[model samples]
Target: MALISPFLPPGTINNVPQPVLTAKTLSLRPWTAGDTPVVFAAHKDPAIALWHRRRIEGLEESQAVIAQWAGQWEKESGASWAVCDGKGLVVGRAALSRINLFEGDGEVGYWTLPTARGRGIASQAVTALREWAFDAVGLKRLQLTHSTRNKASCRIAAKTGFAFEGIKRSALRHEDGWHDMHLHAAVSATPSG
Candidate 1:
């Protein structure tokens, strides 16, 4: 009998594998419609809009963003988890976007609610997701790029063991102008079992 299931092309999965990750003080689960309100609240933080480069208008737009995230998971292109507190309030978000299964690569990003900042929650979520991406999703490498000005994100990346790779010049544009992106990456040292 074959140990592996029938192998399909990497990017062809119809739905993302929803996995719940637990940490010292966080619950990371797939985003759902019920999370729209909390997502809106957290996203309303001015820093979120500034760093993430998008404005969330209200619950309606928040719902749309969640739907879009689901759609991306279905297309095997992206996935996000709502980072929740012990009380189940969404305090942040962690996501792997621009997933190229064919290339065995993906990009990671994260943010925390204003209230959740300074708790080391982003780094914990990133650590959990990194293990999932490498061992469970069987991805070979994960990358993260943030505006050079976002020192907080750089700190989280370092804390989570994503080695500093380099920077992309003026690779992303924001409300102000183009910004350089600092790149960091984590590669699996062991071959996929």
Candidate 2:
């Protein structure tokens, strides 16, 4: 029942119930109903919501999201996580959304809680997700997109080895109308014999 990333190295594993990636003081664990509050708080920050599509309303909405995430988790088609701090408070959210097995690809999306910003949490979360996608799901390539103005997100991608692929004009519609986005990707390294 585990997913095999057809394009990854020979030994990649996928869809385990435990964490697939970890950082110095943080961990990325699968999203659950209890994590909704963290997700809600993270999205409350204007900086985090600027690039995303819709805004979260209140606890009720968060609950609904958690429900949907639970459903997705059951299927193994996509995955989401609540990034926890050393104290275990939900500090952010990260996801490997839009996975396509036939195409051997996945897209990463993430946001750090406002209070957790400027501490390298976003980068760590992104790195963890990329490792999972590459070594767990065995995706041949992983892609990320950030509105051109979202320099911090772009930097996160670059810091995690996602090479700048290109810029797509008017690719995303934010609250401020259409915006340009920079695409970045990390391709699997061919293993040596």
Instruction: Specify the highest-lDDT model's number.
Output: 1
Q: For this target, which candidate reaches the highest TM-score against the unseen true structure?
A: 1
| Tens-digit per-residue lDDT, 31-127, candidate 2 | 7777767667766878877878767889889889878766665555567888888887778878877776656777888887777889999888888
Question: For candidate 2, which ten residues in a row score worst on lDDT?
Answer: 5-14
- For candidate 2, give the lDDT of residue 102: 59
Return the lDDT, model 1, position 17. 68
The TM-scores, one per candidate, come to: 0.90, 0.86
Candidate 2 displacement at residue 140 in angstroms:
0.6
lDDT by residue (1-193, candidate 1, tens digit) is: 9666422255444444677988778889999999888888877788998889888889999999999988888888888999988998888999999887767788998999998899999999999989888877778889999999999999999999999999999999998899999999999876753
